[model samples]
Target: MENTKQQKTNVSSKTRTLVSAALFAGIICITIAYFLHIPIGGNGGFVHVGDAFIYLAAVLLPTPYAACSATIGAGMADILTGSANWALATIIIKPILVLFFTNKSKKIINTRNVCAAIIAGIVGTVLYMIAEGIMYGSFVSAFVLSLVGLVQPIGSFIVFVVIGLVFDKLKIKEMIK
Candidate 1:
């Protein structure tokens, strides 16, 4: 039937679109992680603009692809930055950071996204502290590390706002199709 064939075609097209978005987001996330970092922590914690892309991916793409993009892209950054052990944590943390974000609306600067960014900053900082504490074998030391890590999400929130606004103005999300 034509309807059945059209359904198949739609599915195929959507799959391609999602995959392409994921790949492009991953590449961009990697680039941001590599270059835009502020060394503000004592226990090897640093602020990076990578989470902006992660949030962007989550906002612009579906959950599966957005999580995948954040996980792989952020994981790769850890591996490349001599923080290989943190790769797994990054994979887990990056995706989880966007768990509360629902990209249901086309409005990028809406309430859902702002709340998402704020919650992401809080949860991301706590999660990193726990992970780094376990890795460093000291909860206290991890707390200190988290102080530095706090900058990441705060900085990311700022980046996410500016970037999201720009994307909206430029109709970047619409152009994806």
Candidate 2:
């Protein structure tokens, strides 16, 4: 009975460690994305850094945790940047983007996944554009926002693929609890 109790404690501790690691990695990736966003519109038009990080988190962490982290991290960044008004959108969009991949976990991460990521990125970007475009009207310009959506995903895909490759090489996934 004593040994069984000790074993339970050890399992609990390991679970805590895994959760902490996932949260830490998520925050760090969010921070990286936060710094990457370029301010464009006077209100808050920008490219998100969290895109790659969200994608990475989804691939590595559990679906729920990955989605939570992506939403919280991106939303926090929006608030920090004085785009507090758009926090809801950031929170909503990031998780949905993360969920896109999480829902299809059976599929291997490869060229096809990359293409899907690209599509999701563009779709998310366009959603943001439409939201802001409504407020800014014709003056804000969808052309630039559209370009950002198109380009950022390609950049994000490259980043995620490289990170995934590194994890494969280092056998990090084997360490996941």
Candidate 3:
């Protein structure tokens, strides 16, 4: 009975910590995306490193929590930064990016995660291209604009790798677990 009670307490505590971390990650995502964005394309698109936090959240938190962090943070940034048109797409796409990663890994940076990041980048780019094509009613224009869009995923991958290395060295995933 005592052990069971202790287990419950631990679970409750971990849940609180994870929720708090997700909230914090969301805020970081918004701050980086809104404040540090570089405007690109005529459709109010920009490239930002905010996705790094989303990637980190994916490798650290559970899937649902990571998805929430990515969707809320990226979507809120779009809304707050006068790019509300992209908010819906952001909400839809960001959570999908989280699906490519896993928190079950013992280390933040690993071969599987490295592959996941690459695949996620490609998937994110394609999804955004489709979303933009649909929104603007011109797949050709979207394709042209996607040339610029490609920078984001590439940049995000670099940022994620750098940050992931540091987090791995610090054993942040292990500590969180």
Cα deviation at 110, candidate 1, in Å, is 0.5
Cα lDDT tens digits, model 3, 1-177, are 999999999999878767766685666467556656888788977888787778888888878888888888888788878889998999999889999887898987888888888898888888888998999899998888788877887888888999899988998877775
Model 1 misplaced stretches (Cα beyond 4 Å): 4-8, 39-44
Can you write out model 1's per-residue Cα lDDT over 39-121, one digit (the tens) per residue?
Answer: 55455456787887788888878788788888878877777777677787888888897686777777677898999999998
Ranking by TM-score: 3, 1, 2
Global CA lDDT computed for model 3: 0.83
On the 0 to 100 scale, the lDDT of residue 69 in model 3 is 82
The lDDT values for all models are 0.79, 0.68, 0.83
lDDT (10s digit) by residue, model 2, range 100-152: 66524433365655776787787787778776776667525765666655656
Number of the predicted model whose TM-score against the real structure is largest: 3
Q: What is the TM-score of each candidate against the true structure?
A: 0.87, 0.77, 0.90
On the 0 to 100 scale, the lDDT of residue 98 in model 3 is 91
